[model samples]
Target: MSEALLEGGTRCLRNVLGRFATGVVAVAAADPADGTRAGLVANSFCSVSLEPALVSFCVAHTSGSWPLMRGAGLLAISILGAQQRAAADRLAASGTDKFHGLPWISSPGGAPVLEGSLAWLECTVEAEHPAGDHTIVVARVRALDAIADGEPLLFYRGTFGGFSR
Candidate 1:
């Protein structure tokens, strides 16, 4: 395959995949000792197993927040609601404090659970595997709860929106 062909193929793959809409989430954690926090927005969250209460999300290898959150031992996954688009944008941005103006409460395990999220899951990293440009994180759900009732924030075709009945 020629270089131009490979580049075009990669873009095509991304465009094709973007056709599938997905819900957005904030994957975050706080250092128990210092209360430092790290987080990022991800639309790739998924359930892996029910028997072990496992969930998974992908983080890009270049993500600055992942390294900080990874060492926290505990992580929180907050399901973003349709009204939380600003929060999502902040978390997805680079080189800034993701939680600076975001309201959140710490989970029992010291993970930051964003307030106003539709639901939240407290988890611990069970395993990680490198996949191309991203790392797949499998987590064991220690605890979880639905916090609010609302439409989920979604991403489709490179844009974000809410579902309609």
Candidate 2:
């Protein structure tokens, strides 16, 4: 195995990467004192180390909400289902009210777990690294659950789609 070849530039690279589908999830947290919520949609969520129960996601370096979530006591990941594509789109946008119409619940640790998620995981930030234009966030899972049983929302070819077959 070798590093991905990007001979065609970023546009070509993005198009190439878009061919690989991924599930989307919302990473969020709340400051209980002031009721400030920080969240963003990410398709880069995945498990890392098993012994320590580590999970990870990559956030863009320019994400405004991530800064607020970085120091939180807990961060919750809501794996979006087929019905939550709107939430993903809203959260993925910049400088907007992401939770305006969305329903969610707070974890005992103060992270917001979106309603209707396929699965959810609550964790504490373990480490962060600068990777290209994104920040690699590694967290240790403290609590997790299989929420609603359903197909996941997928991102592929620069669009949202549902799983089939």
lDDT of 2 by residue, 57-145 (tens): 99887889988888666899999999998889888888988888889997767789999999899999999988999989999999989
lDDT of 1: 0.92
lDDT of 2: 0.89
Residue runs of model 2 more than 4 Å from their true location after superposition: 1-7
Superposition error at 29 for model 1 (Å): 0.4
The TM-score leader among the candidates is 1
Write candidate 1's Cα lDDT for 33-69 as tens digits: 8989999999999999999999999999999999989
| Range of the 10 consecutive residues with the lowest summed lDDT in candidate 2 | 1-10
Local error of candidate 1 at residue 40 (angstroms): 0.3
- Candidate 2 at 94: error in angstroms? 0.8
- Candidates in order, TM-scores: namely 0.94, 0.93
Q: Which candidate number has the best lDDT? A: 1
